[model samples]
Structure formats: C-alpha cells, structure tokens
Target: MNKRIDVKEAVLEANRLILHTEDSLSEIKGSMNAKGQMLVDSDQLAFIYLLETDEDFIYAGLPHTIWSKLKEALDKSLPVLLKINDSEVELVQIIDELQYLIDNIKGNANYGEEMETKVTEVFS
Candidate 1:
C-alpha cells in the first residue's frame, strides 16, 4: 500500500522538479528575460527555485535532446523546491550542499553577493 505522504514533503517534492530542470533554471536566469521569468543566482550555488507561483515553470536550459531524457529521469526523482529569495529547500532532499555537507565546508553562500551580481542583473 502507498504510504500517506507528509503534507510538507508533498509540496517540496513538487518543487524539486525545478532542480531536474536546472538547465531550464539556468536558461531562465542566464539568458534573455522572458515576459514572466526570474533569474536564479548561480555562478555561486544552485540556491533558488525562482518559480514563485504555480503558474511559473522552471525553464531547463539543456538542449531538447538532453532535456527530453532528463525530464523523464527528474520526474521519477524526489521533488524539492528551494525558493530563490525566501523559501527554504532542505539540501538533503535536493542534494548534498557541499559547503553545508562537509564539517569544514566554507560558510560563504554569497547569496547577497550573487544576487547583486548575476540574479540582480536580470531581476533588478
């Protein structure tokens, strides 16, 4: 029998799909600004699920061929949603945060620095 999913996990699981589409996430952040899109402050860390609403979709930047395959695999993986600005996604669910993962991992997220540089360049 399928176990009942915890309410919070269910929501985060849906958000992790955004991770599978990091390429799309990167596309949304790195390339041109779409009518309704936000940038993920990368070049530092994979720290944001810029999608703010149910209407928002994470754009995978990988080529059609790559994304096609990745889509299927990602759909099968556990989902987690980490918001770019406010929302918090547990690193364990998405992946090991090397900085946070290691006992001696650097404590610098540079969230503000990255926001000022890459993400802010677009959203700002």
Candidate 2:
C-alpha cells in the first residue's frame, strides 16, 4: 500500500520556508545598507545563486567567497565607525541575520529533500 501525502500542506510549508528565507535576506540587505555596505549587482546575483543552490550546505554559511567579500567590506567600515564613535549595532544585526539565513537555508534544503522523497514514493 502507498502512503498519501497532503499536497496542500506540502505547498503551504514550502511557501512558508521561501517567505522566511526571503525576509531574512531582505533584513540582511537592509542592515547592510544602513551600515553603509552597499551590495552591487554581482552581489545580487550571488543572492540568486544562494537561493537556487545547495552551496549553503557545502559552506555551512554564506559561501566563503561571498562571505569573505562581505566581511572585508564590514571590516573596513567597522573600524572607521568605531574610531568616530559611530554605532555598530546595524552591522552586528547584519551578521546575525546572515547567520539566521544560513540556518534557514539549511532547513530548506532538508525540506526540499523530504519533498523529493515524498514525490518519488507517491509516483513510484
């Protein structure tokens, strides 16, 4: 006998995950902008890559290359902000959100795998 899956439940869960992921990304972007770390077009492309790939699982976080670039930018700005007694709260918040995104994406990957398995079981 085959087990039945609730398609509506699966879809709703997927949408919830996607929306949470997008919101985290948006928060990171907004915090970066507030901290004066402007993400360029290529950076936007990187976000797309992240959304579509399992690269997050591979790196355990924002892929190293992108993380390095973002870190470099933050490193440069943070010192200046510190020297001038400017606030570092937004920058810290960006880092936190980035970590949250990584965790969120990891869960998403697992959910994707689970969905794939369910589809295969249903069709096979």
Candidate 3:
C-alpha cells in the first residue's frame, strides 16, 4: 500500500537529496578541468517529483517558479549552460535555487513544531 507522505519526512528526504547532490557536484567538480563546463547531471522530472507532494507520493514537476527556471534552461538544452553576470545561465545558481526550495519545505515542516508549542500554551 502507498503510505501517505508525512510533510516532515518529505522535508527530510529533500534535505538528503540536497546533500547528495552537493557531494556529487563536488566530486564532479574535482574531476573536471577548470576550462570545462560543469553541466547538471540530473533528471529534472524526478527532482520535480521530490519537491512537489501529494497525499500518497511526491508528484511530477516542481512549483511554478522553479519549474519555469528549469524549463527555461531545458529549452536551451539539458545540462544547463553555466553563465556569469548577464552572459548565460549558471549551473551553480540553479543548484542554489533548488537548495532554497528544499529549505523552504523544511521550514514548512517546522510548522508542526510551532503548532505543538501553541497547543501546549493553550492547554497548559
């Protein structure tokens, strides 16, 4: 049976993904030449599913803002171009935005703790 996704679990899972991605990026960075571009090696749709959740499982695609960014990059081609200033797209920037989304979800999960505190205040 499909288990309902707990918000806290989803946030934690996202954090795990972020950490894993960071490590992978770091390793890839080490193996690449300085002049070579570091293209993103991720499945966009799978990532989108990790970010977006439903009652049972995380669904396909991310929130609109993030999705739009991914789409813009994909439109040009996958493994998004890394750019500086106003030149082109930046891979690191995209990763940063993804981390931000994960952090945002973690914040949402923290709402449970806040609610618990309020409940104590009301009951005690």
Per-model TM values vs. the true structure: 0.18, 0.24, 0.20
Per-residue C-alpha lDDT of model 3 across residues 1-124, encoded as one tens digit per residue: 1211111111112112211121112111212211221121122212332221122222122322243444434344434332212222223344444444434434353435443333233222
* Runs off by more than 4 Å, candidate 3: 1-78, 81-86, 96-100, 103-124
- Writing each residue's lDDT as its tens digit, candidate 1 over 5-78 gives 11111222433433222122322332222222222334432233222223344331222222222234344554
Which of the two, 1 or 3, has more TM-score? 3
Per-model clash counts, in order, read 8, 0, 1
Clash list (residue pairs), candidate 1: 13-79, 15-80, 16-80, 23-60, 23-61, 24-59, 24-60, 24-61
**Over the full model, what C-alpha lDDT does candidate 1 score relative to the true structure?**
0.29
lDDT (Cα, tens digit) per residue for candidate 2, span 12-73: 12112111111122112222212222111222222211111121211112222244434443
Q: What does the lDDT read for residue 100 in candidate 2?
A: 43
Worst 10 residues of 2 by lDDT: 2-11
By TM-score, rank the candidates, best first.
2, 3, 1
RMSD of each: 16.4, 18.9, 16.6
Instruction: Name the lDDT value of residue 119 in candidate 1.
Output: 26
In candidate 2 the C-alpha lDDT for residue 84 amounts to: 9
